[model samples]
Target: MSEENNIPSNAPVFQIQRMYLKDLSLEQPNAPQILLEQTQPQVDINLALSAEPVAEGVFEVCVTGTVTTKVGERTLFLIEAKQAGIFEIRNVPQEQVEGILGIVCPQMIYPYLRAIVSDVCTRAGFPPVLLTEVNFQAMFEAQQAQREAAASPTLN
Candidate 1:
């Protein structure tokens, strides 16, 4: 019982120190002319997530979203938003940390990215572009599968 009391604390700790918009850009190349067109432009959106260790127990996670709208051959507008957070995670097993960063961190930052994208589009004088919800677990699993496949040998 006494030895148990002497053991150092290894309790898990996870916290978000801060969340911020690291970068934002909007481009409207065909501004006035494109605005006059009555036809709706087709919208395309892409997303990516990354995490890196900033300190011994702190990490920086970022989710980047890009949106492009085009009417026929002309480009109506384009926007890219990168949302980031500083997270402090300690005492978690090494194997689990990757999952937490890949899934949980992206899940937390995605909403902010979506909102920023919508707001940027609306403020640029076009209709708001709503981003669809993402399933990070499925994405992570797919990425893992691809990595494994690339590493495995292919039979001729």
Candidate 2:
């Protein structure tokens, strides 16, 4: 029974310490004139995820989203938002750390990022830009494959 109690201490642990909006920017470079255009503006959205070690057994993961709406050659509005979370991951295997950081951590942080982007857009007097759900596992796998390909020697 005592040995069983000790097992939990050595077991893997993953926890979210806190989540926050790390940065947000809304830019309407060509606001008044562009907003007057009758044609629908084209919307472009880009997202990026990153993770870094904050302390021993603690990591900060972030999801950044940029939404740019354009009316012809002029810009309507641009929203850039970064949402981050601090996670505590302890006793996890080294091999699995990369997957957890690249996939799971981003999965946890992305919804908040989406909300921030949408809210900022609506508050800026533009229609809300809803970010589509992401498949972090697929993204992680593709990144891993890309890294592997880059590391391999090319024979011409």
lDDT of 1 by residue, 1-156 (tens): 237666456778789999999999999898787788899788888998889999999999999998988999898899999999999999999878989999999999999998999899788876789999999999999998999999999999
For candidate 2, the clash count comes to: 0
Q: Please state the error at residue 131 of candidate 1 in Å.
A: 0.4
Residues 5-90, candidate 2: write the lDDT tens digits.
66567678899999999999999997687778889989999988889999999999999999888888788998889999999999
Off by over 4 Å in 1: 1-8
On lDDT, the leading prediction is 1
Candidate 1 local Cα displacement, residue 135, angstroms: 0.1
Candidate 2's TM-score reads: 0.93
